[model samples]
Target chain A: MEVVDEGSDGRVARVSLLRTPLFEAHRAAGARLVEFAGWEMPVQYEGIMAEHAMVRERAGLFDVSHMGQVEVRGPRALERLQWVTANDVSLLADGRAQYSLLLAPDGGIVDDIIIYRQQADRFLVCVNASNREADVAHMREHCAGADLVDRSDEFALLALQGPRATEVLGELTDTELSEVSSFAFVDATVAGVSCLAARTGYTGEDGWELYCSAASGPALWAAILDAGRDQGVGPAGLGARDTLRLEAALPLYGHELSLEVQPFEARLGWVVKLDKGDSIASAALRQARERGPERKLVGIEVPKGGIARQDHALLDGDRRIGTVTSGTRSPSLGKAIGLGYVEPQLSRVGSEIAVEIRGRKVPARVVALPFYRRPD
Target chain B: MEFPDDLKYSKEHEWVLVEENVATIGISAFAEHQLGDVVFVELPATGDEVAKDEAMGVVESVKAVSDVYSPVSGEVVEVNDDLPENTELVNDDPYGDGWMVKIEMTDPTDLDDLMDCEEYQKFCAETSG
Candidate 1:
């Protein structure tokens, strides 16, 4: 593909200080580059669907170094985190990670993050690349006397995901990864680089996310690619990443879960603990649980044809009910699937709906969440 | 990319091969490369009248959807039905198997305004850069 010099505004400058160790490697590999959140990231390498299928069938590598990694240290770190976040952090043990949400005073979602308990006093929080600065600022404001450190620049993260990911990564390390359960991590080394291997990923596949130093990232990435070459592990970019996550029904920050939407409305009530010993949003969550959400997030599957895109109007007969938040033509399912907020009464499992695509109403059904689930 | 000297080209990156009054229309190699990994193609039906430089069909890729323009004013005589399932033929053999439609040209003199292989190559190079 030919590189066209297209310039936009200073949107890259206003976000955060973007840093990635694999910028040169991505560019050299003929990746079409774009500014995502402050970082210049690869949108596609060979093609979107090809990489998307590879991650579903075999293995794919991703330079997730752009995601923010913040460390909270000190004796009262866990206690402080539990008060500020919506998840029950007391249930987490050392080396275990939990998906949690940072909530505002009114119970709105600030950001969705994965909290990894490294030790009793130390925790690693991985947030979206676009919300890094705001997340850090939010953490500092809630920390009070706790030690809050932004380790995003110092560390680089890589995700090796798919069915063969474990086989490829296990060959490189001396430690056996067979015992590591899902959402559990182990401290180890890869190619002499000190790394933390987590058995967690966004794709609905068995995989590991390796976090290492920024300087050692390039070598570690090359080593993994070299080791997994025969096993069909290829470099994947943001396009595949988006499709994989969407198929799994994961909520993206700007799309499903945002500061304007509450966790209850987004159907993430499981993460928000209402009885976790008096947080600021506890009373509000309790009230929300009692009344239930007016609008609920649901999955819609288009049966015949047409693709449902963002901002497309969803209807029941002639009455407009809601709008699609995220939608795509699922390459795996060979059909169009989307997520949208609809009236709670109409958000049932076999509810019929219509999505207006290009002035035509396509038939769709509100099916169960997660249009695709990985076989265990 | 090679543009055969015998073929005629349109500004919208469509090529025309006129044999008497029957003209075969397919997108240029540049167009196929630009719209990577063609997933779905909407073809014009046979017996449909098409205007010159007008949209005759639509091609969808993973990234974007583009309209395929007709190079000559004519009636669609035949359409490539294989492209609906195997749209990647556009990327593989754009000139041969990827021919979108066959048209019975209303006016064969319209081919004179189209570019030859040399002129089309230079036009693509200058515009692409």
Candidate 2:
């Protein structure tokens, strides 16, 4: 990244904004671009609400190339993965993906990652854009002897999510996407581009995440849209992506899972396997679980207006109880929904609280995880 | 993005319409488009005194929160009562039904301080570039 001088229009240039391979496609589709992490990405194209509904009803495509991918291979790859991650890696067979976390030594979360078991001796991990460099560093430090390589630039990831995901992608690929069960992946050719199509997504919809070469990203994106045009496939952006994920109650790295927050406190204790033989924070996690977590993650809903943003103090009357991590007006639920940390006693559903929004206390209540769920 | 010639524009992207001593204020279409979807709006109440070039209200879009700076100093005579629940009007018709406030001016010459459509258009191009 480099700092550039001001433009001729007297405007400061965002010179460091990294453009993904699908940047031209997004611009051609009339996207509203914004800086995310270091990438200049689309926040919306048609509208967040419409795109949100489209994903829930029909299908939506997302360019997630900003998310970094790491390749781990060698004879000791499995042994190394089981030691660095918080999940039971041995249980994850080939072609399967598991949601796991890279835990810091202090029992804090470094990043929530997805490990795709490519083979007996190889794996691929997807990490957050903001934490990509840090996550790679963490893995390299702990994952000695195994061939760990930063393969981020080698792949462009696209997420086609919704009930019609299989159908839309089915039209473009010969993989028979319906055969790719949840969390399973297969090497396939899509629109003449080689891809690894996996039945995994953040939107909590029936969908596939396609990993293709960076050079074929723009072509694959255009081909998917062109193939799924009649299926009402809209190219969704980060705006709809945030709203959709919020509705699903998925923890974003910086928001819910951070260096300061532990897995137990983030309500992601299920991913932690203390018996998995001394992973990064296994001992600390055991100690943490023994002495109950100080605070727990709870869903907060503002039935009234005024969206509660991150760092908005959660209150039990005048006393500050916790803080909101992520908040948005959920397009699917038609209510302002958010995730926050609160004392364990007040973490139960139906417990009442208030969110301080712009100096005003907006009435809110503790709710269950996931403000919305797709039709079965 | 077209800024109507009849409406005076503020550098902060608020549009103003003057009739008699009172001026109706709203964010320009350019501002609304820049702000994706307005999820919430907070307006000054009637009888509240607003100063020129000062923040009088707030407009929260999906991605960002921005202060709605008042272009003229005046007594707040009217506020859009329907705007709290119907914030989409700010995006739907920013020039007409989306008018946020009506300020009875203490200084009628405040209009001279703001730019016309052409000047504001150039300002938008320069800033956006």
Candidate 3:
């Protein structure tokens, strides 16, 4: 939230990064902090691979308080939401959330958001931290007299994710977390702290995203850690989060979904509901759906050699088809995996492709969207 | 960071244990800490020839990728085959079990150009500080 220092001319003056409420906790835990999206967040605590394995086999805690939240409250909230977001917000019942996209008129993504229908007339939208200011400004213009409030600074968000997450969190909350299905949420007191717990996560795991008052972050974090210490619940940072999400094939805002990348091209067409009525980018998305997207996002696996980073060219012989959006050495899969946009014909699973890394074309192949899925 | 007194060190943070003509090479404990949880390692073939200060292998960590340079030129006689399967060894026991390659040095005199434990420690502190 505090990564930018603007000069009088509106230019970026200096990198005066902001620290989250859990900054002290992270420091005390001996975390490696890195500047990400204008926030000095811990990229790793113990280590990425160890933390990643712990989350998959046990449980892990994440400080995601840097992410932005905006509340749209008014009688016309649904109308305003429908007019701006690409997803059909009407389908979301109260206490439910849906992953949606804020799009420009040309079908380009402004930011990927999670819209929580708190009530018939009140919605809470969670957005990427990097796009907080822009997202708030954009929504303000289209709020149509609705109460648009930036609530990012007021809450400290925590994600207790992994297989044992429910067990760890259940010890502190009276709410039956198991009853809350995926994408559902409830208001409850956790660890003597009143918080909003949502059954949603970026990691492909069963977890809860808890939002509490900024002042209560330290106690809540300590209570959860102490409760789950024997269960192997350790603190994780953004580094493990990135690898986990990449393994699940989730799209990050700057990496996968960008201003130049449309949802159709990102293989997120399912979220775009043309029948939801005349919403932002609906016409263009409708045309894209009818005709077909020029490029489609697909999973690319580098069987061997170097890891493909963002912006690396996806090549078919000498011609460039597309570029890598997000990539990492999957700690779960034991191989290199990446998400990238390529020609629709080349998007098929098992299609052969190559990623140009440092001038050499590394052999790769197309796989399914999600490289990893939790065993039910 | 632990830099063994008996080993020769490179400014790049590699440590070499020279026994006659064959030299065992590995990254220092300081280097392993900085890299953070190595997931994958790419080692040169056993018979591949490497020059001093040349990039000989790659270490892919969860955070980023880094090149492993040869401290002394020679033919790679042996590589830790267990590394590709258990890259965590590089972090667990960087100086001992995590030794990357054993090279038959083309010229053992190259070892004199390297730093001792005290010098490498000072180098790490200066750079890290």
Who wins the lDDT comparison? 3
Give the per-residue lDDT of model 2 (tens digit) for A1-376.
3345588999887567888899999899899888888888999999888898999999999999999999999999999889888999998889999999998888998899999999999999999999999999999999998999999998899999999989888887767777778999999999999998999999979999999999999899989999889988979999999989989999998899888999999989899888778787888889999999999999999988588889999999998999999998777876788999998988999998999988899899999887888889
Q: What would the per-residue lDDT of candidate 3 be over residues A1-376, giving only the tens digit for each residue?
A: 2345678898985667888999999999999888998889999998998899988899899999999999999998999889899989999899999999998888999999999999999999999999999999889887677889999999999999999999999999889988999999999899999998999999999999999999999999999999999988999999999999999999999999988988989989888888878987888888878889889999999998778888899999889999998888899998989999999999999999999986789999999869999989
Q: B1-129, model 2: which lDDT tens digit per residue?
A: 678999999999999999999999999988998987887889999999999999999997776788999999999999999898888999999998889999999998989989998999999999778
**Residue-pair clashes per candidate:** 0, 0, 1
Q: Is the docking of candidate 3 incorrect, acceptable, medium or high quality?
A: medium
What is the C-alpha lDDT profile of model 1 across B11-125, one tens digit per residue? 8999999888999999999888777777767778999999998888887776567889998998999999898878889988999999999999998887878999888999999
- How well docked is model 2, in DockQ terms? 0.67
User: DockQ numbers for every candidate?
Assistant: 0.43, 0.67, 0.64
TM-score of 1: 0.88
Model 1 chain A weakest 10-residue run by lDDT: A10-19
Candidate 2 TM-score restricted to chain A: 0.96
Residue pairs that clash (backbone atoms under 3 angstroms), model 3: A3-A38
RMSD score of candidate 2 (Å) = 2.7
Instruction: State the local distance difference test value for candidate 1.
Output: 0.87
